[model samples]
Target: MDKLTSMNVFVRVAKAGSFAGGARDLDISRAMATKHIMHLEGVLGTRLFNRTTRSLSLTDVGASYLERCQQVLLEVEEMEAAVTHLQTEPRGVLRISAPPVIGSTHIAHAVSEFLKIHSDLTIEMIIQSSPGDLIDEGIDVAIFLGALDDTSMFARKLASSSLVVCGSPDYFEQYGIPETPEDLENHSCLVNWAIAPRNKWLFKGEAGYTGINVSGRMQANVADPIRIAAISGLGLVMLPTYIVGRDIEKGRLKVVLEDYTSPPLDVHAVYPHRKYLSAKVRSFMDFLQEWLEHRVSVIPPVME
Candidate 1:
């Protein structure tokens, strides 16, 4: 009779594929379970289950309802846990979104470490260029690089990453190293469309800030391809130190224009504003900020 109870019973029946099995799991009688499902169907004006003596199956509409019901039940459980303050330790699946570069490298490594500490929690990492609609996409946290455009969602500054312009030994040998940002026009500068001002690379020097309109033989939407191309001596690339830091350390790439400084981009952990911030998200936000700070101190932005 109770809506939440009926929903739970329906979910159990749908999962177990039999009224008796679901009732047994819930410690309720088969008739009662059937009554709950019937009550739900009556309220919704649809048949939730296709009945038979041997097999039980859900109708098309019932299948959709089952998914929604599961989500609702999970939220209700989390809400109660939060209100009671019984969920201090992180639990449940944390869905995160981040750009491809950081997602695969830094954020992914942070999650591995976080999971080791919080064994009760699970994580789902979504790697994409855009942050997208966090609420609509069901993202619990999104690691955002650069400036925050949207003012609606809540964001916490995680860390800042400096940018570097670099190329392979052979590329520098063949094309000559760029002494100033103006010299980039003479060389092939691999472009990453994901970064704003795709055609222009900004730099600050003794003179002042300058935006150089650069062109290249190759350009990609994501940084990896362009980075690889730069490593192969195809062109020079200007990218955040986080993305190219290891490469510079490994001698795979060489940093040029060391005298100049490009504006550092601030990384932020973004999430939709909610009345109750889940323990998992709160813990991760604090953990990641501290983690990145330690990592930055241990590893210099550029080897050269």
Candidate 2:
């Protein structure tokens, strides 16, 4: 068996977390997948996976090796593309990572359109909260919202969405609208840990920028749940306009503190720094930047 082919199989199996799952992805028999693993173990003289009938997991060394294999395969793919003169046109698979809300909505739509233009390109999108280890997971690009914390990766600004503090009309009627950022203290303010400044909401007022350390009976890591809670009249929520735009438009939620403005959440496309950039990644990045800019260019302070 080719060493490179064995490495690819091993990576598939490791990611799938089961030989059957990996074999299914590769369109190979379980026996063939097992053979590939055994072949690699024999060459490396190390046990890559600890297997039981119920589960399969990578060993410490296997975890490290998986990262190396992904990098190697990526380089080989780039080299082949260059040799075939496909460097100018994207071909093969392009893996992406993105936050769930935007990933399923805007980013996914952009990818579908890009694929239409480049029929030879394939895209695999992983909707995840964090970017994770890009190199280890073999992700070509990651769509990030808000500020960039990791300075190691290269990033490009794609677009921005305004943030809004809102709640159900019933809740506002019952609790009374918060007239100022500081007035949030008197009301229940639902918090989403996923967005930056998490428990603290920021706003720009006559006194300049201020951050309010907010707390509520409800809190979540994702924006959707928080949005749902606000719609049900549980509490107020601070979320990006993209997540709560429709709700505001439909009157399921009402925007508050219109006099104050919050910083727009910046959307970014991030990827690991690589010396050789593949046409698939480079072209998609350029396309997505332009696509998102037009789509999310102007997020009104209130969807209405």
Candidate 3:
């Protein structure tokens, strides 16, 4: 009782001018082709084909129905083709969210490079310290650092950056360098309040992991402010090496507690969970992964 299938068979039979020929083209038995045409005729309550011993031909009603069926089939084919193209080619506006420091330094470049390759795609980037609600914000992908808290979304690890506790040479000269994690309690540490365990920092020692509660005169929700404060000799700040690497190289900041390594901050691309991911989201995620692999040396060579 599939009306579309019946219509298709009818059109094939009409064009072929023989029930056997139509059945052969459709890979159906001749009897099944006759049955499909009969089913269509029953629905319309009109004869679709005039059959004689020697040949068969379409009736006036059959001619009209065949023309209409051809149109319908063509439209269905077009719809399918459009969907196929969407599956293969990435298009549409890709909404992304990321932390301000990472967004400005790394993601901005990646996005610019990605746009150069994908001419049809448009990008909207939202840079903030807080990881906003992806669904409410209509975010297609969220670039994140550290551990993922929300299990509802799908996350792919992009790269990992070493965490270093550093301060300006002038600041260290005044406040003195911390020889151990315990010394941080006495030092004025500029904390990134945006990250969890705001006043507390973790470090790995010879024994094991140690957590230290820190206090400072300055605190901010973003890393850039903390980084600037550290550079300006306001206080010591702990940040990813990617952000502080150049500063350290230039002697604007000096890392402390070299033996006590902090946990490496892992970067990830998170998206809402769905049965089928869109081509735009998938393509961008893949591109970002490859881009980070080539662009950032934050991750250790052993890990690579």
lDDT (0 to 1) per candidate: 0.88, 0.89, 0.85
User: Which residue runs of candidate 1 sit more than 4 Å off their true CA positions?
Assistant: 1-82, 206-208, 296-304
| RMSD in order of candidates | 12.8, 17.6, 3.8
lDDT of 2 by residue, 1-304 (tens): 9999999999999999999999999999999999999999999999999988898999999999999999999999999867666667799999999998888888888888898999998899999999989999999899988899999999988889888899999998888999899999888999999877878999997787789999999998888888899999999999888788788878999999988899888999899976668789889999998877766655432222
Superior by lDDT: candidate 1 or candidate 2: 2
Residues 191-303 of candidate 1 have per-residue lDDT tens digits of 98877777989888668778999999999988999999999999999888877878888899998998888877678999997557888999999999997875542335432
TM-score of each: 0.69, 0.70, 0.86
Per TM-score, the best of the predicted structures is 3
Please rank every candidate by TM-score, starting with the best. Answer: 3, 2, 1
Best by lDDT: 2
lDDT of 1 at 200: 89
Better of 2 and 3 by lDDT: 2
Candidate 3 has what TM-score?
0.86
Which runs of model 3 end up more than 4 angstroms from their true locations? 1-3, 18-20, 28-47, 51-55, 206-208, 297-304
Write the number of the candidate with greater lDDT, choosing between 1 and 3.
1
- Residue 41 lDDT (model 2): 93
On residues 144-189, what C-alpha lDDT tens digit does candidate 3 reach at each position? 9888888988899998778889999999888888898899988899
